[model samples]
Target: MKVRNDAYLKAFGENLKQLMAKSNKNAETVAALGGIETKQVYRVINGEHSATLSIVYAIAKGLEVHPKELFDFTFQE
Candidate 1:
């Protein structure tokens, strides 16, 4: 069975990449701040793997941003 939610992960990954770029932070720095390995960040950024809530929370905290900011939402009328 697929454990990771693909759509959410993909969106999250894209947003994370954008955030990292905007912050001028590399994978190594993000990994250190999130207490994860650099490879994990690479995988997520590449959309090859998904991150758990713990990882997401860590990233948000490390970035000093809210989790909602990591998402791009669209509401239809």
Candidate 2:
């Protein structure tokens, strides 16, 4: 089944993509750095899955940024 991409997830994914671009990183690199599967990174980036708090922390760690920055995007929900 195709997963629904909520506004929040979409916004988060966009923010992640932007950060990845800025840092010259990709899903594989982020996954390695975050200690997650590359597919997991893609799923989050594609808005196909909602990451857990731990995953968010891992992603932030991978990006070398504060977790709050990942959720800095404006969203209605």
Candidate 3:
């Protein structure tokens, strides 16, 4: 369970990073648009913590992308 959770977080984090890069918005701008703190953005992007679905949606919305984009992770066993 722990291993799966770790893998999930890593993949989610990577997805967030890619979206942010594609967004062309700096962390602070994205956080402000998402109505979250910059630190929270870093936390999610750095894989220091997992985010709730609400948070994921907010981030995707801020990035001007579909929420599904955030969940487009590679499958793992």
* Candidate 2 per-residue C-alpha lDDT over 1-77 given as tens digits, one digit per residue, 9 for 90 to 100: 22334877888999999999998998888889999888888888988789999999888888888999899888665
Please tell me which model should have the higher lDDT, number 1 or number 2: 2
What is the Cα-based TM-score of model 3? 0.88
Candidates' lDDT values, in order? 0.73, 0.86, 0.83
Which 10 consecutive positions of candidate 1 have the poorest summed lDDT? 68-77
TM-score of each: 0.72, 0.88, 0.88
Clashing residue pairs for model 3: none
lDDT of 3 by residue, 1-77 (tens): 98888878878888888888887887788788888888887888887889988888778778888989889879474
Error of 1 at 2 (Å): 8.8
- Locate the minimum summed-lDDT window of 10 residues in model 2: 1-10
Q: What's model 3's lDDT at 48?
A: 80
Query: Once model 3 is optimally superposed onto the true structure by TM-score, how far is the C-alpha of residue 55 displaced, in angstroms?
Result: 0.8
lDDT of 2 at 37: 88
Give lDDT for model 3. 0.83
lDDT of 2 at 50: 92
Candidate 3 stretches greater than 4 Å from native: none
Candidate 2 ranges with C-alpha deviation above 4 Å: 1-5
Model 1 pairs in collision: none
